[model samples]
Target: MITRTVVMRAVRTVVFTLALPCLLVAVWWVASDSSTSVYAPPLRTILSRFDDVWTADRIRGDVVPSLLRLAAGYASAAVAGVVLGVGIGLSRTARAVCEPALEFLRAVPPPVLVPVIMLFAGIGDTMKIAVIASGCVWPVLLNTVAGVRAVDPVATETARAYGVRGAAWLRSLVLPSASPQIFTGLRQALSIGVILMVISEMFAASNGLGYAVVQFQRGFAIPEMWTGILVLGLLGVVLALLFTLVERRALAWYHRSRGARRKAGSGGA
Candidate 1:
């Protein structure tokens, strides 16, 4: 049976997908209406800069560095968040104490944290990665904790009946069951990670895409700044698409598991 809820959700998704590119183009067209030197670059002009950015030297010098920093920092955040989240989730006392602090810290904006991080780490790749990792970790940690705690008690008990316990139990039962939530957290973290990575570079750096934007802007290269911004936007879109594909595959078992339960319930009813 097709429920109104499911149908409406599908309709909304279709509407959103259709609306997004239209909105982007509309905004681009409006902005491009101006020929003024400071305000906006024409869409065609921004696209033209891609040839310069994607050149072998530019790719190696700027884009590659930014991407490498992003990946390194984000990867560290993922690993640390999952481990710490698992620890906190599994221990009630730890959760009670740590959750409040984490809550407060997570509420603090990452841009605010950059100066403090830089004070210690300085303006090197270390600072860049540290800032990104700091910004990204909370989402992953909180999500992992939520996921672990959300495991069905009945399923856990069943696993226990088969002698599962400790680390073995977590790997065999918990992570698999909690994977969907974990991935959700990861997707959120990556979003945050990307924003912070650029901001980190923009605020203070001699190289990277953000630095390129800054360099161009200082020299009155508005079109190049527009190009960098556009590339970042496209990068975000591509990354989100990749994550969605991974999410669908990774959560396939979880989806099927829930679907099976639903089918059983409907048959009984």
Candidate 2:
């Protein structure tokens, strides 16, 4: 099963994955060695401090809470978005009634809502979660609606003709057709979720990665701040990789279908 093409592709992927990061780190290591800048501490200094600052004790206080808030907010958004999107996509009346409100709310930048949320939710973890959820919902909701609405008319008609109805119809036809777009929305929402998590924490919080980063910066602990930044960047990468794996698993059928189509088109040509 391991063909030359597959082997080559794997090699390419590994190289592509490691190349940029290795190059960047090497460059930083070189460039920062001679730097006397107070803010831009040497990469070696950052790495040394990174080890100390991101230890288990610090992670328990900072990283865990941030990750938990992110998960809660993202999960809440995903559920609400998919449900509301389905409702809106299925019913013209619902779309007509809800679209304007959705548009209005989506227009308001997520960060602006942090203060409002804090005022009501009182600067607690709840407020941060709410702020993040508010931001994350829009992409999933809008994409789901678009995807559902864009389902092939012929497919819908065929299902109707076959006496398919209600939940069965949705399960059999709508969801499969709309899944790719829904996944796209989820991907967008994931990044937005991270951004909102940081914003909410930075805006108001006694604990969190963002809070710790700001505290470090305020105290002029530049290397510690860099470690926070580095940790966040690494977290984003890990989250993205995790999402990609989940997406591939969830949309395996979709990928197979696309591959089949490509083969068909190639053979026809």
Candidate 3:
């Protein structure tokens, strides 16, 4: 069964993990054959560049800072999104005051804000993190609101009957119900985070996979450029799979308890 799951996962994984580069290679080979002399570097050349890209100097100088920026941005978005979502879901007054403004804010494209954000934040990690956070926070915030609001009122009443009322009541009754949606949001946000990280790096940074790619492209080092892009794409796939695993583990109890309840209900009926 685990093998089956792994195999199924391979299909999705390979598209990101393998197929893209394979496709790039096929494109390169074809284009190289055509006479795009300067533009087309074939598969072997790009493949060879991966070693240099992975060198300790490259890793330390570029990859560490990129990962740090992503972590800070993603973590900030997750925390703020979850907190504000919970607040919106739990309190009508707060929701009324905050939700519309948030919706408006979310509607504005993240890249558009980069120029404005950079004015205050400058072209550094701060601006990158802020841009990433802004881009990712919306999906998580909305998903969390949906999750909490969708919890059954009957369940809340049951909790109340057992004296589970107020904030404590919510912690016992609503949050568990909302956990799945929260995780779903986190997964979606993580993907968005990766995209934004790359975009931010491309626009303003001195280091990162995007920076490496841009630098190589400018210098006409086509293979190195491709290598940087490939590494970034791989990083995205790895992070997505890791988040999915975390989601499955976090919601395992919820799924089991739900299945058991449904089975018991069916027997009684």
Give the winner by TM-score.
2
lDDT of 2 by residue, 23-90 (tens): 99999999999889999989999999877788898999999999999999999999999988988999
State the lDDT of candidate 3 residue by residue for 100-210, as single tens digits: 798799899888888888999999999999989999899899999989889898987888788887778767777788999988898888988888888888886889877
Instruction: Report the poorest 10 consecutive residues by lDDT, candidate 2.
Output: 46-55
Estimate the TM-score of every prediction. 0.86, 0.96, 0.83
**Residue pairs in clash, model 3:** none
Best by lDDT: 2
Name the candidate, 1 or 3, with the larger lDDT value: 1
Error of 3 at 207 (Å): 1.5
Colliding residue pairs in candidate 1 = none
Task: Give per-candidate clash totals.
Answer: 0, 0, 0
Give model 2's TM-score versus the native structure: 0.96
lDDT of 1 by residue, 1-269 (tens): 99999999999998998797989888877778665556476777777877875688877888889889999999999999999988898789999999789989989999899999999999999999999999999989999999889889999899899999998999988898778878988999989988988889986797888887788788887877888887788788888998898888988887888899999999999
Overall local distance difference test of candidate 2: 0.94
